[model samples]
Target: MLESEYQNRRKPPRHLVPAAPSQAEFSYTLREATTEDLPSVLALYRHYVRNSVVTFDEKPPTLRAFRAQFEHTHKLGYPFVVAQSPSGDILGYARVQLFRDKAAFRHTVESTIYLGPASTGRGLGRALLTELIDRCEAAGIREMIAVIADSGAEASLALHEKLGFTETGRMGKVGYKFGRWIGIVMMQKSLRRK
Candidate 1:
């Protein structure tokens, strides 16, 4: 299904329903991403590549490569979203990719999320993830999986757990980065009942 069609079918949680805002409240906007957001999105991922093992990549992909990835996900009818400040700064992004190539795996997706370095610890990640899950569920995705990079990634683990994901599996010492072997933790949440 096209994204716009899927969006029209989405039933956002009550808090996100459109209503005039009170002057005392502040809110961030979550919306479908465009190629124009790639530079900022790539920069955010680059920080993790150079300084952390959150992603296994040792080097950041070029902007062209990143744009190709964004397009591929969009073409598959999956959501690629960005969280923006009221002033329009791109604070973070989240998206889903095919969990595997097999035909039977079509109902599942792997999720990725990243925030600008300064945007951490402010609940933005949860907001992005929550919206992603909602959209996926609306589109009839049966499951969402998160392949967290390491067991030491407490914040990521906690965020997924808080959103009803459970640890499903782990591969010890499966990834080598930063001069050590890092483990992969697999977590999953069911989007719908059978």
Candidate 2:
């Protein structure tokens, strides 16, 4: 589906939707990410890896490792994009990867979005995800799945719900993080109608 077409679809209830980022808070630009952006992207993800259950990685990957991951995504032709400040700082990023390695899963993709700590609540996440969805649909992807760790992540859950994803399943006590058990929430959005 096209971005405009997706925007025209019916949204969930207002209360379920996150408040729009105030104009004063959303003065960034969105664009395709490049290899040079990997350092900043890793930096943003490091926070989540170290302090939050959002990611299960206890230790962040090295720059070379991150670069290899980025290159792999690029080689697969999946979208890897970033939100940038006017001064060239990366505010956030979103990307889509194959949901599974099997040939039958070719039409499905899993999404990952991360924003700088200071960049949250400013609509950058939504913007990045929206673009990712558009690009995925345009590329003939049939489904987008979010394996969201920590079911307590209200903002991330609400954002996906608002964008037409439905809660498909949940896994309990699957991730050990921060000295506690973290549950996973599986949310899915179909980009094309059957």
User: Model 1 clash pairs?
Assistant: none
Give me the runs in candidate 1 sitting further than 4 Å from their true place: 1-27
Cα RMSD for candidates in order: 15.3, 12.7
Query: Each prediction's TM-score against the native?
Result: 0.83, 0.84
Instruction: Kindly list the per-residue Cα lDDT of model 2 for residues 61-172, writing each as its tens digit.
Output: 9999888878887887888989999889999999988899998998898999999998988778888899999888777788999999854578999999999999999999
Q: Candidate 2: which pairs clash?
A: none
Give the winner by lDDT: 1
lDDT of 1 by residue, 1-194 (tens): 99998987796877898897665434579999999988988888898899998899998999999898889888889988899888888889999999998989988999999988878888999999999999898878999999997745789999999999999999989889889999899999999632
Backbone atom clashes (below 3 Å) for every candidate: 0, 0
